[model samples]
Structure formats: structure tokens, C-alpha cells
Target: MLQNPIGISRLVLASSSPRRRELVASLDLSLPVSVLSPDVDESVLPAWTPDETVRQLSAAKAQAALELLKGRSGAEGDELLALDAVIIAADTVVALDGEVLGKPLDEKDAAAMLMKLQGKRHEVYTGIAVLQSGNGQMHVESKKTIVTMKPFTEEKARKYAATGEPLDKAGAYGIQGLGATLVEEIEGCYFNVVGLPLSLLADMLEPYGIQAI
Candidate 1:
């Protein structure tokens, strides 16, 4: 038989992002780990710096999951318990010229963001937080990667955006999906551009006694 030394009975992931979930799943954690999406207000805070934004949002997500565990029911028992938890949360953003490029409001907005990014350089930031409620140990950090997109005609941009993939993605693009063709090169963590910096996430989680298989 195999074993894990993380001293964790379950790992909780608190985000609705499919990308994050997939990245965490790749860890091949023990089958007892549970994934949960916490409801959080994602609106950007006024005057909040980019680095702080990622940290705050991730911490908030962890806090939300903590509260949920404090109040919600579990299959084991009717009453709430700490459940030896190690919760993970993260957020990603794309920015250019100090302006945060959130999910495009519409096709027009997507096109506008793409225009500024095509043939130009922009940064992708991901904030990660790991909290162990059973012992109150917490770790939080952020990672950045710069991605450059190849120049293309408006017709090409329009065609890609029409697939509806850009609308849900930050900076109006996803380097991991159909958007891969647009990437000329990247200067940092490739997984960060994919929406989760796996190596960095591993480094952060290591201190908390959790090891991804």
C-alpha cells in the first residue's frame, strides 16, 4: 500500500475555475480530497494593486470555504467539523498598460483587448493561497508570466473570438486552448499562462506538509 505524509484527510479546492481544478487534480492526490466552489464577489477593488488583488481574492476564497465548513453539513455527520482540511484557492488576471483586462463584456470588448495585445506583450498574474484550518497555518503568494501574441489581421481575431472561448477568458484570450495559435512566446511559467503555476503552487504547498503525487 502507498501513503501520503501531508497529514491531511482531504484537500479542498475553493474555486469555480475548471482550469484550476484540473491542475490540482493532476497532483494525483489521495481519493479522499474534495473539491468545492465557494461563492465570492469577484469585482475588482478600487485602488487595489495587482499583487494585492491576487492575494486578497485567494485569501477571501479560503476564508469563504472555512466559513462554509463551519456552518455546512457533511456526509460523515450532521454537525460541522474542521475535517482536517487543507484548502487551496487561486485567481488569475491579464493586464496591459496598467489596465486589467477582465473577461470581455461582449465581442466588441474582446476585440478591443485583443487589438492591444496582438503583436504586443502583456502579463499574466496568478495568486495562490493554501490554508490548513485544522492547525490555522496559512500560505499565500502570487506569480507572473509575460506572454506575447503574434500579430494577425482583424479577420483572424474576429474568427477566433466567434468561437466564444475568448469571452470567458481573461485578457480576452486563453493560451492553453484554441488561443494557443496566437501566442508567439512566453517569458515565464508556462503553467501560469495556462491559468495555474504548478511548480510555484507545489513550492507553496510544500511548506504546509502537503506533497502532490
Candidate 2:
């Protein structure tokens, strides 16, 4: 078989986020994709900005998955390592007034987060890390989108939260699903707000001789 230069035999997503998985699939790339859940601490570091926090978290996940792949294949030879699959990892967060808002714990928490986001503009930051396996050549980037939510009452927030969709999403909302009705306007990459930025992914993959189109 002809060897691909980057040595990536397949694509792996080092995330358990169903949204991310769905987004990547939407790219319609005709390559083998596998999902690996990386066990990395996601606690934000003290004094790190929202962008930095997500970037660090994404990189951590990617590197952890890469190391695990290396260990699994035991492909210590540089050439052998280069020929492994590429791992893509990402982390997303919603930030308002410099405070990061992660997934809500329960209905109450989701309602509270939605209430805070209502009638306000918030930043959605998604950090992505893509790496070639074996040699571990990697690319990391963060994309931000400004989302303005329509003014709504706490009662509305509670009603939406009760549906249980917001409970598992950062900032108590998922822009791509039922939560779309809550968004008033978005100022950046829509896909970034959805979780994985397709344009960014294309750019990141291009240098490695991969194409999403």
C-alpha cells in the first residue's frame, strides 16, 4: 500500500461530546473515525483567561489521547509513530463578564445559568487540538463567538431548562438544537458555537494533507 506522508491511517476524536462527534461527521470527510474519551482534569487554572483555559484543556485532551495511542501501538520508531491516526480534541466554554460557565449540574442550575444569560451577550469559546499520531505533530487553536440571547423571563428559562436539553451543555444551552430559539444574534463562527469549528478544522487539517471537502 502507498504510504501517506503524514502517516495518519485514520482520524480519532478524543472527546466524548456527542455534539462534537456529530459536527465532525457533518464535515463529510471520507476517512475512518474513532472516538476516544480522554481522562483529563478540566478544572480551570487560576488566573487563566477563558481562551487560555479552553486552549489548555483541549491540548491536554489531545496530548493524553496521543500518548495513549503511542502506548497502545508501542510504535516507538518515529516512522511507525508517524503512520498512526490523527487525534482531534476540543473543549468549549461559555463566558460572561469574564466568568466561565460550564455544564449545569441540574435543572435548577440550568435555569440559573439561562437566567443569567438572558438579555445579555456572552462569548462562546471553543478550543481545538489536532495532532498526527506516532510523531505527534499537532495544531491547536481557539475560536470565539459572541452570542446575544433574546430577553426572556426567568419563567421562560425555567421552562426551557425543564426540558433537560440545557443540563448537559455549557452555558446551559445548546445552540444547534432546541436552544436556537434563545439566541438573538451571533457575531462569529456559527459552527464554533455549535462546538467544532469546521473552517478551523479544515485549515488545521490542510497542512497535514487532509481534506474535509
Best by lDDT: 2
The lDDT values for all models are 0.80, 0.86
Please, what's the RMSD in Å of model 2?
A: 3.8
| Candidate 1 local lDDT, residue 49 | 72
Flag regions of model 1 displaced more than 4 Å: 1-6, 74-81
Candidate 2 has an lDDT of: 0.86
List model 2 lDDT by residue over 161-193, tens digit each: 999999888999988888999999999999999
lDDT of 1 by residue, 1-213 (tens): 112235566678887778888888897765455677889888878788777787888888888887776566454463424657778888888988777777898888888788889999888988888887665567788999989899988888888888888998888888889899999999999988877799988877666557775
List TM-score per model, in order: 0.89, 0.91
RMSD of each: 3.8, 3.8
